[model samples]
Target: METFITYVSQNGFYIWEEFYRHFLMAAYGVLFASIISIPVGILIARYGKLSSWVLTFGSIIQTIPVLGFMAITMVAMGLGTTTVITTVFFYSLLPIIQNTYVGIKGVDSTVTSAAYASGMTRLQLLTKVELPLAVSVIMAGIRTALVVGIGIVAIGTFVGAGGLGAIIVRGTNATDGTAIILAGAIPTALMAIVADLVMGKIERKLNPVNKTATA
Candidate 1:
């Protein structure tokens, strides 16, 4: 514990910078994935026949080994944060896509029918009724992707992309690396926990039932 504290105090700036990089890489990946996934999810949900195929493809992509995927990407994108970001982006697709599909589909059917009968077009029904109710589930998927991304980003060190993993790697090379490892590992774990908590709050707040209760 003393060694961990001492190492952190002495190298706070370096560690802080790496921590920021780690988070940004993960955040950017999830952000980009969300942009594409949410729409695709909605599309599949509307066209239920497509749901199985799209989700199957996502599952296959998700199953690929992280390091292997990184290596495959590195050949084209080359090294550094870009490669790491690309890998994170691909890996983030499934959770966000799945959650969005489920969330949109889960919206009450009666409400949707009522909206359509009230002279709303497909776009209006989707935008006003479906999306509002589904946002929380979509957020949950984003949260999962971000948390997973944080862990995956640790492999960034091997790809020449710096993150907290770089610190942990440095510890691996040292004669006494336990404290150094903890310095990096602790922050990574804490970051995941914080991300999950914040996203959970956002999800709950977006939920209509919660809003009614609080009101």
Candidate 2:
């Protein structure tokens, strides 16, 4: 307890800065993944044949070992933040894409038909009806992607990317397993919890029943 407290007191700023840096990198990765995946997912959901092929390809990418992926990226991108960001971006795509595809596809067909019958254009039907209804599930996917990205960002330390994992590596080299575990475990857990809470709040806000029920 004393050692942990001492470490925190002395290195809190450094730890916090590293945590924030990694968080931003992970966020960038997720944001980029969402940009690519959400539109593609929506299109795939609208077109069955395309959904099959895109998902199959995404699944193949997901099957690649994370270490191998990062190692190759480190070589290609040459050991910096870019390698971490790109690797995390690719790692994040599968969940977001899958969830977006499922969410939009799972929206009630009757609702879509009604929108179309009511003279909504395809764009209006998609934006105003399907997407709003699907937002919660899509947000869930984002939550999943964020958590996964955070974990992988820690591994980014191995390739010269900085994070709480830096402390862990330093601790290990200094023969202090306690520091490694504390540094790695605490920040990761905190990020996961905070991400889940924030995303959960957003999901509830987007959910009509919850909003109306509260009102």
Candidate 3:
């Protein structure tokens, strides 16, 4: 307890800075992933034949070792935030794409038929009906990706990327730095928990049924 407080007091500004770096890394990765994956998912839902192949590609990417991916990307992107963000972007793709595809595809066929009969264009049907109904599922995917990205951003510190993981690595190198390890590990866990809870609320708010009930 004394050691923990001492560390926090001594490294207060540094800890806050690393926390911000960790968050920004995850944010950029998830932002890019969401922008690309949501559109690709929409396309896959429309063209059912592409779903299996695209999802398989994402799964294969996920199976790649994280350090290996970072190392390779670092070689190309030259070991900094870019490499970590790029690696994180790839890691985040599968969940968001899969969830978006499933959510959009799962809409009731009869409801779609009715939408078509009402003279809604393909775009209109998607924007006005399918997407609204699917937002909850899509948000769930984003939540999953966010949590994954948070964890991976810590690993990014191994490759010259700044994050709380630096504290963990430093602690391990010290003779007796258990408090140091907890300093990083505890904050990382807490960050993940806070993110999950916040996203859970967003997911609930996005649910059409919940909206209707609340209305």
Candidate 4:
């Protein structure tokens, strides 16, 4: 306990730096994943053939072990932050895509029909009605992707992308268990909590019906 406390006291700045570095990389990964997944997901929900192809391709990517993916990426990209970021981005796409498909599909058909009857065009109905109603479910997928990306970004330390994992790796090498716990465990838990809270806020804001019920 004393050693852990001392380490924290001495390395506070390093810890914060590591946390932010990983957090940024994870955020980038989520952004990239969403860029590809959101549109693909919408298409999949709207079209059966496209959905099958997307699911099959995304599944293949998911089935590959993280380490294997990293190794292949490093080989092609020659290792560094970019390799790690790319790996994380690919890993995050599956959940977002799947959730988006499910969320849009889950919208009530009657509501969609009414929107059409009210003279809303296809694009208007999708953008104004379906997308807003599906925000909660879509955000659920984003939350999953964000958390998963954060966790995977830690592994990027092996390829020289600095993060909390640096401390864990260094501590492991030097036989310092405290380093591993402080570096790996705490940041991950904190990231998960913060990400969940942020996403929850967004979900609430998007869910005006729930807001009205409460009011």
Error of model 2, residue 158, in angstroms: 0.8
Tens digits of per-residue lDDT, candidate 1, 1-215, equal: 89999999999999999999999999999999999999999999999999999999999999899999999999999989999999999999999999999999999889998998999999999899899999989999999999999999999899999999999999999999999999999999999999999999999999888978999
Superior by TM-score: candidate 2 or candidate 4: 2
Candidate 3 TM-score versus the reference: 0.98
Stretches of candidate 2 exceeding 4 Å from the true structure: none
Q: Clashes in each model (backbone N, CA, C under 3 Å)?
A: 0, 0, 0, 0
What would the per-residue lDDT of candidate 4 be over residues 1-215, giving only the tens digit for each residue? 78777788888898888888888998998899999999999999999788888988888999998878988999989767898889989998889999899989989999999999999998999999899888888888888888888888888888888788887887777766775576566877799789988987887776757856888
- Winner on lDDT (2 vs 3): 3
What does candidate 2's lDDT look like per residue over 32-102, in tens digits? Answer: 99999999889999898898889888889889988799999888889878998998899888888898999
Top candidate on lDDT is: 1
TM-score of each: 0.98, 0.95, 0.98, 0.93
Between prediction 1 and prediction 4, the one with superior TM-score is 1
Write the residue-wise lDDT of candidate 3 on 120-173 in tens digits.
999999999999999999999999999999999999988899799999898999
As for candidate 1, its clashing pairs are none
What lDDT score belongs to each candidate, Candidate 1 first? 0.94, 0.87, 0.93, 0.86
The full ranking of all candidates by lDDT, starting with the best, is 1, 3, 2, 4
